[model samples]
Target: MLTISRTLSLPESELVERFLRADGPGGQHVNRTESAVELRFDVAHSPTLPEAVRERLLARRDRRLTDDGVLVIQGRRFLRPGAQSR
Candidate 1:
């Protein structure tokens, strides 16, 4: 990974938010893990995203997109918040 901080022109504090959940292929174990990571970015309000990035995100027809235009990314790898890694 290219230094996570250096690779980003914006600071970590500026990132909208990151949600980690358990993604699965582990069968019964899948329900007990939260290894999936979802990135929740508010295209209309995140100060960290460049204008181009914002435009592109909003253009997507995602189920997570609210009528007001908030993008909701869910880490569905695990049904719960804590478990084993994927």
Candidate 2:
């Protein structure tokens, strides 16, 4: 479970994570390692989210929110050495 706040938590089942090769600064291993992470959450259909929160999240104009209402977050700043495949 992922805790969003004192009262809100999202189930791990609702999250989808994908790992891909990250660009920049990993020496020769950069091309071979899937160290970057993309996390996806279905805000519009999440049963764990409150209706009010879901509506508010969907109403936001952020580019990370897709037309299908899935929120995509990516992290690529630091690469883990020898990160294994999922």
Which candidate should be chosen as best, given lDDT against the real structure? 2
Q: What lDDT tens digits, residue by residue, belong to model 1 across residues 45-83?
A: 777666887788789888898877776666553234444
**Where does candidate 2 stray beyond 4 Å?**
79-86
Compute each candidate's TM-score over C-alphas. 0.44, 0.85
Q: Write the per-residue lDDT of candidate 2 for residues 1-86, one digit (tens) a residue.
A: 99999999898999999999888888667688898999999998998899999999999999999999999999986645665343
How much is the lDDT of residue 73 in candidate 1?
A: 69
For model 1, name the residue pairs that clash.
21-34, 22-34, 22-35, 22-77, 22-78, 23-77, 23-78
Q: Quick one: RMSD of model 1?
A: 6.5
Q: lDDT per model, in order?
A: 0.61, 0.90
| Error in Å for residue 68 of model 1 | 2.4
Q: Model 1 segments beyond 4 Å from truth?
A: 1-39, 77-86
